[model samples]
Target: MDTEEKSNQLELETALNNQTLYWQANLKLLVKLLVVWFAVSFGCGIILVDWLDQFTIAGFKLGFWFAQQGAIYVFVALIFVYARQMKILDRQFDVGDDDSNQEPQS
Candidate 1:
């Protein structure tokens, strides 16, 4: 019932809200990246291969290239993209382990 206690409770509530929002954002980013990964790896590589095969690239069928190589490249690129995005997300959430700039604890 004291003013200090009420202020502390409000600060805790705000922090919890911010943490929840950060997690929600992180999950949404993860889902979106997974969807793109699935679409490239499975959709283009398998389900739509027949349609894509009608085109040719460097003496290889587009569908075959996608099924064999293009998807792998995309997956690798996605890994780097995810890492970069997560770094930014970590900064946004005040997480991760770059501690040189932090104040020393007593």
Candidate 2:
């Protein structure tokens, strides 16, 4: 291949590699967040209910709280956490919004 063609090919490979890495990181974050959500919602709310019920929080059984309110609260928190983390990830991967790159108005 000519020098220019080889350069373009190298750039394409680098871009593909970066895209793969970005997706891997995104999936890793998603899986971790989902695990935390599952652990709190299912594990604490169901499987460990008996064990957690032994404790009280604000006069409510811990397990009951998880089953009733805690899971919803945790899910909401996770939404915000996901947004924030994705923002950071986008910035790290150079995939964030680029207003400056937009075409100028006619």
Which of the numbered candidates is closest to the native, going by highest lDDT? 2
lDDT of 1 by residue, 1-106 (tens): 6999999999778777877887898898899889989988799989999999999999989989999999999999888988898878767766545684342222
Q: Candidate 2's error at 77, in angstroms? A: 0.8
Clashing pairs in 2: none
Q: What shift in Å separates residue 84 of candidate 1 from its native position after superposition?
A: 0.8
On TM-score, the candidate that comes out on top is: 2
* Residue lDDT tens for model 2, 30-60: 9999999999989999999999999999999
Q: What's model 2's lDDT at 34?
A: 98
TM-score of each: 0.86, 0.88
Candidate 1 regions off by >4 Å? 100-106
Lowest lDDT 10-residue stretch of candidate 2: 97-106
Tell me each candidate's RMSD, in Å, in order.
2.9, 3.7
How accurate locally, in lDDT, is each candidate?
0.84, 0.88
lDDT of predicted model 1: 0.84
- Clashing pairs in model 1, backbone N/Cα/C closer than 3 A: none
